[model samples]
Target: MSRSPTFVRALGYLALALFLGMAVVLRFVIGPDVSFTPQAEIGRYSDADLVALGAELRETGQAGLYKFILLGVDFVFITVFGLWVMLVHAIRGLGPVRWVGVALACAFMALDYGEDLMLAIRMGLATKGNLDPAVLTNPVSLVHYVTLAKFAVFALCMLSVYFVSRRRA
Candidate 1:
């Protein structure tokens, strides 16, 4: 399960590139007005808040772009970042602790994907004018909890990377 330093470096560069590209798009293209979407929100947001954001995006004619960023750019970014984290752990030789990093990477990526999927589904329903409260409840709740879980796991992943790097040094 060991990875070469070269491979790890390449993955890190790719992850960085993807992250920067996504950031630029979010900052410039999506802009600040529609920047406060659920995916970017760190904590639990109400169903009304989600609906309001969706409506705002729709009204501003940025709903499609927002969805594209979430489902498209963010998806690629999450996969690349997760793989980079796993590869870094492997390259650093964390011994038994390496497995924990790998598991954290997997959990982080899963939670992120789950959150994105829920938001996308909610957006889709909003776009179609079919955002029935009953249908929205489960997805909204999933997005809320999954977003929190994603952040916690991401923090753990970063801490694991730090520990591995420190051990290597």
Candidate 2:
């Protein structure tokens, strides 16, 4: 069964609010001006770069907190938000097949959250002063591949929105 239009819209708005709030926290609170912002291009990070990131996380006490925020909150919320974006069109009469976007959103979330978890594990090791580059090869490679897939899916989802709008217009 499908969800109500009002409920879906509310979820979408709530996701937006969470996103905005997190952006504020990332930019103003646990930010570059104080703590080194975590790298967005994590897939490109070398072993040394990961070590440096760990050191930054350790130095700024962001290792633990950011892990929770990124994996637990941001990842989940953004996935749900993307679902709402993709589904709203279908609910409004685009077609039921558009629900496939929901599946794609979940895949994006898995890739993103998996990447974050790998980094978080490294950060935890860094906090303990036990980070070893030799152990990072697999996770780093996985993160790189996942990041690529995640972005590709996300781009497709966004395009669906654009096309849907243009078709409606």
Candidate 3:
């Protein structure tokens, strides 16, 4: 049941291409205009900040684009990036190290997805003018924490892969 090296390599390349493509699209094509996009803002943001971002998106008619980037492009990007990380670890064949990298990759993907979903929900509420402070607080906090977790896990995963590959070499 072992996969061929060629097959695994091909999949890794494909995943990388898809991930990069989506990244370009997000960065230059349909991404939000604000510099402090929720996804890029690793630091903690106030509920008020989140609310204002939503409002700005709505006012600028970028709300739909923001939601699309989160639920659509980013969804695909996260999946492909996670798969790419796992495949890289698999190719490295570092036993426990590989497994740890894979686990971290999965965790990163999950946190990213959760962060995007929470942001989308916040945006939806903002779009609907349901800006009750109570309604916004939980999602805003969730997005912030999840985003931080996602970046941390991603960094760990990449470091594990790098160290494993270097050690093998």
Best by lDDT: 1
Runs of candidate 1 exceeding 4 Å displacement: 1-4, 125-132, 135-140
lDDT (CA) for every model shown? Answer: 0.75, 0.62, 0.70
What is candidate 3's lDDT per residue for 44-103, written digit by digit as tens? 776567767777777777777777767877787687778767876777756687788788
**Residue 37 C-alpha lDDT in model 3:** 71
Better of 1 and 3 by TM-score: 1
For each candidate in turn, the TM-score is 0.81, 0.70, 0.75
lDDT of 1: 0.75
List, residue by residue over 109-132, the lDDT tens digit for candidate 1. 999888877776666632564567
Positional deviation of 159 in candidate 1, in angstroms?
A: 1.3
lDDT of 3 at 138: 54
Looking at model 1, report the run of 10 residues with the lowest lDDT sum.
Answer: 121-130
Write candidate 2's Cα lDDT for 1-169 as tens digits.
Answer: 3444677778777887887877787777667734344434533554445556667766878766666677667776777777776566565435554666666666666766776666566556524536565766644444556667777876776666555545542
Error of 3 at 21 (Å): 5.9
RMSD values, in order shown: 3.3, 4.3, 3.9
- In model 1, what lDDT does residue 143 have? 74
Ranking by lDDT: 1, 3, 2
Worst 10 residues of 2 by lDDT: 33-42
